[model samples]
Target: MHYIYLHGFASSPRSTKARDLSDRFAALDISLSIPDLNQNDFSHLTLSRQIQQVEALFPPAPAPVTLIGSSFGGLTAAWLGERHLQVDRLVLLAPAFGFLAHWLPRLGDQVEQWQTDGYLPVYHYSEAKELPLHYAFVADAAQYQEESIARSLPTLVLHGRHDDVIPLQASLDFARTRPWIKLVELDSDHALTDVSTEIWQAIQSFCAL
Candidate 1:
């Protein structure tokens, strides 16, 4: 089985969660590919671009893949699973479901200003500074509707009950209709950083490691 780890938005392969999970997989004598979704150009990020980049990294055919993603990356993983039969399983950490709806409101007036300016300055967790991302990011993301992901597969979602970003209800709603998904609620927040071990344990059980 091939393993791939996709980090959250504004984050990188060096994120605490990514590195921790990578170490855990390595301890099991397995390699996890954590690609930089930014593609060295966060200024013009798009969901389609990310999907293309990660799909290219997938091992040729017959080799089944297991995708592990966090936040926006988790959302990306779900769509990939829907589009590709090679994806065998998914492990999502606080996925950003209805992300635009939940996030755009937080930006408030900046949303309109970003449209007018064609860019918005947001904090980059990995880069440790604010980065100007093009408004095209929002335009591209709006094209992907969460309700369209109907393909069924073995999936596990680890969401924080106290999550303020992508409310817990999002996962609950998602798992409600999809019997193949197992939703595990944790005590942490949106980051799920405090319960890394629990996440790893769940992955091991779900993946049968």
Candidate 2:
């Protein structure tokens, strides 16, 4: 089985969770791809192109591909699975399905400032401080409505109980519509800091099936 690890928005392949997951999979001699999605020219790449890059990294045999995506990457994984990629299973961690709904409002003032200043301020959990602006522009992008994607593939969703970013209800709404989806609630925040073992166990069980 092949696995792909996708990091969240404004996050790199070097994230704590990514590194931990990589180490766990590596110990099992399983190959996984955790690419650096933090391109300075992210605005220039279309969503389709981003998906293409991910697909190109995998074999073409239509084998079962397990996708583990966090935040914006989860949204991208759902979109890819629905439209083009042949994913056997998916694990979405605090996915940002309502990106436009939530972020557009918060970023309303910063949008113009980013356009004018050519960058916007962002926070990095590792740095524990404010950082310079990084930009990602989605053009005529289709939303990843969880219900729509869940209809096609078996998915496992893990969300924090106290998640401040993407609400737990979004995943709950998805589970309501798609009976194949399983939800595992945690006590951590949006980053899912302390539940790595739980997440890995869930993945192992799903892969066994």
Candidate 3:
């Protein structure tokens, strides 16, 4: 089975969770793909392009592909699964569900500036900065219809109970609407730094199934 690991917005394959998964999968002789999606202009890049890149890394339709997406990546995975792209399973970590509602307004003038300047400024909420501007464009382009999408695919959703970024209740609502969805709540925050073991366990269980 092939596993695709997608990082969160403004994050890369070199992120802590991505590197950890890569190392663990390598030791088990399991193949995984984690691509860098932040190496371009945020306003110009679309979610379709990222999906195409992921498709190129894997095989064509009818082949089994498991997607593990974090934050914005999780939202993208949910969208892909809804499109019926032959996904075997989906694992979402602290997915940004109503991102367009949250980010687009906050980005305000930056969005218009992106249309004019051809790139959006990377907004830094905390100490960590320096991510690609195209990430915002991708986020802007994402549309969440989890209720319709989760019906067709087996989904494992991991969200922190204290997730300040994306509310945990939103994930619960999503799980409540879908029959094939499972929810695992942890005590950590949005980053899920302390729940790696549980996350790995969930992945192993889903992959085995």
Query: Highest lDDT among the candidates is held by which one?
Result: 1
Residue-by-residue lDDT tens digits, candidate 2, 88-164: 78889888777666676778787777767765666755446556643445333443344566446788889999988
Ranking of all candidate structures by their TM-score, best first: 1, 3, 2
Pick the winner on TM-score between candidates 1 and 3.
1
Q: Model 1: per-residue lDDT, tens digit, 58-108?
A: 999979999999999999999999999999999999998898999999999
| Backbone-clash count (model 1) | 0
lDDT of 3 by residue, 1-209 (tens): 67899888777787888989898899898988898765444435566666666767777767888999998888878887776567888999998777666667777777776666655667433226643454446454654345556446889999999987788987887788687888899888989978898899888888883
lDDT for residue 113 in candidate 2, whole number 0-100: 77
Q: Between which residue pairs do clashes occur in model 1?
A: none
- Residue pairs with backbone overlap in model 2: 120-133
Which 10-residue window in model 2 sums to the lowest lDDT? 136-145
- Model 1 CA lDDT for position 49: 90
Judged by whole-model lDDT over C-alpha atoms, candidate 3 comes out at: 0.76
What is the lDDT of every predicted structure here? 0.94, 0.74, 0.76
Candidate 3, run of 10 with poorest lDDT:
123-132
RMSD of 2: 3.0
TM for candidate 1 is 0.98
